[model samples]
Target chain A: MQVTKREFLVATAALALASGMRSAQAATAINYWHHFASQSEMAGLMKIIELFGKSHPGIGVTQESIPNSEYMAKVSSAVVAGGRPDTGMVVAERFADLTAMGALVDISERVKGWKGKANFPENRWTGMSQDGAIYAVPAYAFVDWMYYRKDYFEEAGLAGPPKTFDEFLIACRKLTNPAKGRYAFGMRGGAGAFKYVIDVMEAFGSPIVKDGQAAIDKAAAVEAITFYSNLFVKEKVVPPSAPNDSYRQIMEGFRTGQTAMVWHHTGSLIEISAALKAGEQFSTAPMPAGPKAHIARVAYAGNGIMKDDHVDAAWDWISFWGEKDAAIALLEATGYFPASTAALDDERIKSNPIYQAASQTLDFGRLPNRFVGAAGWSESVVNPSFQSVLTGQLTPEQAVDRMIEGLEAALR
Target chain B: MKSVLHRGPLAKLGDLSETRYWVYLLLFPSLILLLLVVAYPTLYGFVISVREMRLTRPGLNGWVGTKHYVAMLSDRVFWISLKNTAIWVTAAIALEVAMGFVAAVALNRNVPGTKLFGVLILLPYFLPNVVAGHMWALLLDPRLGVINDILVKVRILSSYKAWFADPATAMAATIVVEAWHGFPFFALLFLAGLKGIPEDLYKAAAVDGAGPIRQFRLITVPMLRTVITAAVILRVISLVNSPDLLLVLTGGGPGNATQVLSLYAFQTAYREFNFGYAGALAVVMFVILMVFATLYIRLTRVSKD
Candidate 1:
């Protein structure tokens, strides 16, 4: 057949268009919304994205980064406004709230059948499940621990990091010297103050919500509050700005040698290492135990399938977080403790003596209170109430009463 | 090369533009836009307020008439926020207007540095509330803050004080920062108003042997009454609606000492996931603003002009 130039050009163009459309149709698009904003966190996320792309050639994933403080607000608004991403990042404490708001899909069957699920411990699964249904897969953990100045301890002739609350207070009194413009502890009574308030309460054997009821041991909570606040108010071991010190203030205080100790998590190791030397200058230790119980939080942060339309792709994206390579990459970049047993064995993590505290905490750490309104009650009520005690505006008893009252209102 | 143009749909639209109802049709687009942007949202909020619409508690979502309002009656935070909002808006407005008036009058004198002064005066208005709040927080930091350093060095303070930590000082400190940021808005408006006042009136007053202060009181005051009223009303609305500055500085702490209505509602809605209660709080704010605007306009008698 004799073909004209016009006909041949038209035929080629049509063929190209048809092939492009077919390729586009075959590509499954999945979107993940998360709240990882730090440079290291973003780098880790990018590495995971690159890894995911290489493994799943048929799927295309897009990630949206929201600020951690505004993540829940954005997620809630998105759920109500109805443009939810295919998958979403969920932390242990937020799992209940996210599931309650219908932002997370039940993936019990998919999670149960996956062979790799065996790599995660029972506690890991427990954090991501509610009402006997799975919502997310564990990715990493923020094992609560303490960062202390080893040099300062040696100067004060202290033995080591305190093993009990009483020892901790004595160490603070001995280390604190106002003339040097240094305090013993950087008490975070500001934005994220809620975590420690709850921790102290738990350490004193006060169950925030017992058997799905608002059951707080008033005496224990008051004791916990009194002990925590006395570190600032009565003992003067914390800085004067303790009532207004959030993450930034406290971290700055610790890094600048204004405070000897700061309570954070394994996540801050990379940032802290940049400012101070490990072992020689600073070190990490397990949080000191209370009279009744030892308390630390092994908060497992993970990803959940928010929409079921692309369930297969969503499953791959979430489950990939548990893979050894992905977990190790995240650990290297952000210093996040891996949730998978396989990744925890990496030599890079095991070689660091500073990580010993986190390892110890893993054996005994409790999960944060997981309930529908846990986030709100902790933040708005508990934080301010505790700060009130720190600032001498309220007594420990008054603060405890306010917390119980606020929790009741929140649950209602 | 010349070609014959076909006037198709364009010609039809031109023809339609010349019709008798064209102006009304043109106005219809703007009316629709107003209904969409303004009316729809306000009405939607009103509807949401009367419903049990807690996002986290979706199972309990249903129509519940005034349940949120009834709860608000006993809400201690709500009452505290209401009282705080009144003090915040009133004190802030009074201070902002005074500063703006003084600045506008000084700049109107056409001094050597008036132009530069005007630009410098307007700088605060350019900063977003979030930035201003954070900047002030750092400046007022108890340990490393320059403000504290200066205060202590000059013996104005016994020692470095934690401004935001004390309930007595928290709101006052936030108000000072807010006033600094907002006075520029009034200055800009008042400066424009100052420009429009006829020089001839001042000259006539001078011929009658009136002093600068007298002419200002007699002529400039009455002439700029409308501008003052408008600026004050707009400012009151802006301050009432904005909770960003307070959010950054205090987050309505050290124990709700700096709590205002807008911040309270925001915490309730986003933090507590209690949209119904937040909506009720918002409705109260809306009602308060509406009544204030109405009474303010009547009292000022700006319509008489």
Candidate 2:
């Protein structure tokens, strides 16, 4: 049979298109939305993605990084507007809000069947679960700890880091020297200030939420607010900027020697290490004990399915983060503690004295408050209330009353 | 050579253009676009405001007429935000206009380096609000800010000041930063309006024995009235709607000292996940802007002119 050149070209194009479509169909592409904005966090995420690609050749993962502050905004919009990603990063504090909004899919069945689930303890899953249904696979942890300047401590004739709040106050007074333009603590009283405020309240034996209701011990909370605010208002140890010092300000304060100490999580270890020398210049310690009890948060950040359209592929990708290699890779790059029991035993984590504080915290650290309206109550109420105390707009008693009123409203 | 023409859809459209139906055809795309982009979202916002559309508490999703609005009546934050919004908008506008007028007149002088000065003046407007906020935050930082260092060296300050941390100073500091960023918008528009005014008018004023200030009052101000009205309205709308800079610098902090209506609305929607309440707040803002625009135009008599 005779064929025209045009017909031959058309047939060739058809064949190519068919082949491309087949190839595309064979690979299941899943989109992941996360808020890992830091350079090191991105590096760790890329490492995990690279490893996941190698392990699951048939599944393709694409990631979208949202700024941590705007993560919930973006996710909520996605949920309401109907363009949800297949999977997303879920922090302990935001899990309730995310689940309440129905942004995360129920992964309890998948989690139960997975072999890698054995690595995680029941407490690890507690943050990511609601009403006995797991929503995410635990990836890494942000174990709370204190970063203190060793040089400043030694200069002040302090033998070691403070173990209790009373000792911490003494050290704050000793380490602070206004003549040298140095402060004692980098109090994060600005955005995300709610975390420390809640912690302080809990440390003073105030229950934030009990049985999904506001259960704060008013006296304890009042006392907690007074003590925390005193570091800035009364003691004059924290910088004047403490009322507006968030993560960046606090980190800058500690790294530049403007302040003697800061309270942050293990996630900041890599960033701090980049600026200051470990052991000699600065060192890590578990957060100081409060009056009634010690409180440190081991906030487990994990990944959950946002949409179940590509359920199998999404499941595989999130589950991979629970494995030892991914956790270790993340820890190496970002200094985030591993949520998996197996990854905790890695030589890199075990050998580093810098990680000792985080290791100790793993034993006693409490998970962040996880209830509906918890985010709202903390951010809208606790943050501003605490700041009011620091700025002398409201006394500790008034602030506590305000917080109690706000919490009740939130629970209602 | 002879040219050959083909009759097709293009020819058909050309024929259709001559008909009365052509105007409707041209208007059709824009009509659909307006409905989709502007009308639909606005109506939806109104609907949401009257309903219980909390994303987290979906179980409570139902029509709850005037509930959010009623709640706003007694909301302490809402009242504080309202007062702050008035101060933020009014103070920022006054500063922006004064600075912008000075800048516009300076650039209009046609002096040497005016082009470079124009570009320099417009640089702040070119920056995103988020970037500008961060830059200003660092500049006013208590410890390492260059501004603080200079202030101390010049004896303007005994020590560094935490601008955003102090409730007394936070609102004022943010206003100054906003004015710096937004004045360029007025400068550009006013400069354009100045260029269009006849130089003969100024010459006549000068001949009539008007001094520089008198001539400016009589000629420049009168001529730029329309531009001034347009610029004020646009800037007010923009200032009222955006919450980015405040979100970056303060997140409405030091006990909601810097909180404005827009920022409060944003926190209500995103942080609290109370979209219904947010929608009500937005509706209030929308009404406020509408009333302000109407009153402003009436008071200035821009339409009469």
Candidate 3:
């Protein structure tokens, strides 16, 4: 039980060195949170993460999966509790609110030095920037289109998709058969009816909010709402249930041949492709033009790095994911479209017909205005007025007035 | 003789000598848990209700005092939600209680396959609330639903009807779904009460030439008062707080026709991020529930008297 002073000092030194190594190892571990629940998608994401980890041996990546329904709530709570992950994936629209809250680190300077920054389209880059400060990295873009049953379209004497909104209405009228339990369109006329309203308004060149004020009461906005409402109440081309159908139901309507065409996002392409593999015949077309030129509203999901003690780690991960090569890999693995124009030429990506066709429509992609208080715009203005118009509770004019009132109050 | 002379004051207080300390020790854990779980969150929620808290905000939100309360009071949506809650509570409770009593009575009799029937009656209650909402939604679907299919096939109607798409039908559909899910609770409670009632009371009634309905009105209703009152109170509280089924079934749609108070409060807080206003709305709802609970207790006592 007796030891020399020299031996004791040597052992103490060895223990301190081991503890220092352990702390250094722990420091390199970075946390990433995402809301992808699909098995295939998660596997693909983990593969990308593994590849990144392999390329950078100094940093370790940990993935946390959150359900889509509760993703926002969990992220919000995490930020407020000061336990936010280094990198988090969020919908593009939500980035504004988080940036406003100062929860996200402004990566403008870091992104400027990123090799792939110039390759991304201006629109995609603009989506991640607020007041010239880039707060997020653009990942993928989603655009809505009219998906129709090709066989039904032909049977109704339509040689091809309608090129104009009037022609679309005519085709709908011809395709509707109440006796056979089929409708011309499977419209979701409830709170979510705003999706369609947005499509039509954008097509008609009606600004959702113009000059920092809600311009829904404008003539163009009124016309768009009227056209949408007429499909349910006046034209009778849509079923009554359209008023309450969610995105899922609307898709189901198309799958089950309950409607001739459905307005939805390109995300449906995967489902449609799967259905086609199972012998269902369907095709998609760009939304028809209004009195003006056709305009497609694009919604996207992006990844944002939170401003925390781990800022360097956050930038590293963001650069890893947003790099053109990495973005291309993600696009091939998942059905998501790369936000970078350079990735559009990836042979593996271009080989997919859906991606090819979707790329052609990207030129028409438009995003909603960046209102100062945009978070409340959807629930307060879009949903309420959209519901009112669709349900015949208010005329298109009245709905516009109501939306203005609500939006003005919310903005104030 | 010396030992008897030395008995202490603590010993004289029988049972306190060996167990008093143990009683306090045993209760300590539960007391701490209650304070941590219930009291803490309640106080925290109240604190949050007075401030302009936003999840997206960076720092501590400034206090707005009674501003949130005033805004919530003046908000038309809040008032509309209150009216909807009133309608839902009244309709769901009344229908559930009546149907449950009838089902319980029918099960109490010597009917064929009584056990099977009882199990079947309890099935809907056991279903996950969200799944139940989806199931009913499918059944009520205007174009593809089975109920409309059967109704049309059987010559009951000429055309398909949107049961949940119209404002009038949407409210009715929500009430029906809520009632369907709720009745089993009342039925089970009433069945337990029925079993506990002595057979002698029925025998005495029969001897006195009391008719079945008259006996039910006099004996069964009077005897089952406590159980019935408890069931009603529980159901009312549940209906007031839980509006998820309606949210899923109708999405508070057809132009806010079925937007119940709970759903409004949820959207206000979570969706709108107006936590302060939402808290005020919640406080109002809590007060209403307390008032209702008090009235129910008083009414039950008066009926017994």
Please name the candidate that would achieve the greatest lDDT relative to the true structure. 2
Q: In candidate 1, what are the lDDT values of residues B197-264, reduced to their tens digit? A: 99999999999999999998999889889999999999999988999999999999888888999999
- DockQ of each candidate, alpha-carbon based: 0.64, 0.80, 0.39
TM-score per model (chain B):
0.93, 0.94, 0.90
True contacts kept of each: 0.66, 0.87, 0.58
Candidates sorted on lDDT, descending: 2, 1, 3
For candidate 3, give the DockQ.
0.39
> Model 3 over residues A1-412: C-alpha lDDT tens digits?
9989999999999999999998888787778888877755776688778778788878878889986645665766666666888888856666766676666788888888888788776788777888889888887777767787778887988887787899999999999998887888888776456656766876776766777677653688788888878888889998768778777678777777788888777766666666553123777777778876586667666787875666777777777776666776676566677777777678866765545446657777677556545656675567766776777788888887776677786555
Give me the displacement of residue B41 in model 3, in angstroms.
2.9
iRMS for all predictions?
Answer: 1.0, 0.7, 2.4
User: By summed lDDT, which 10 consecutive residues of candidate 2 chain A come out lowest?
Assistant: A22-31
Give per-residue lDDT, candidate 3, residue A226.
85
Task: Estimate, for each residue in A1-412, the C-alpha lDDT of model 1 and write its tens digit.
Answer: 9999999999999999999998786558899999999999999999999999999988888999998888999999988888989999999888888998989999999998998898898999999999899999999999999999999999999999999999999999998998888999999999999999889898998989977779899999999999999998889999988887899899989999989999999999999999999889999999999999999999999999988888998999999998999999999899999999989988988888888899999999999888889999998899888988887778999999999998887787
Clashes by residue pair, model 1: none
Error of 1 at B88 (Å): 1.5
lDDT of each: 0.91, 0.94, 0.77
Off by over 4 Å in 3: A1-32, A37-69, A81-83, A277-280, A307-318, A323-334, A348-353, B1-32, B56-61, B109-117, B302-305
Candidate 1: list runs displaced more than 4 Å: A1-27, B1-23, B111-114
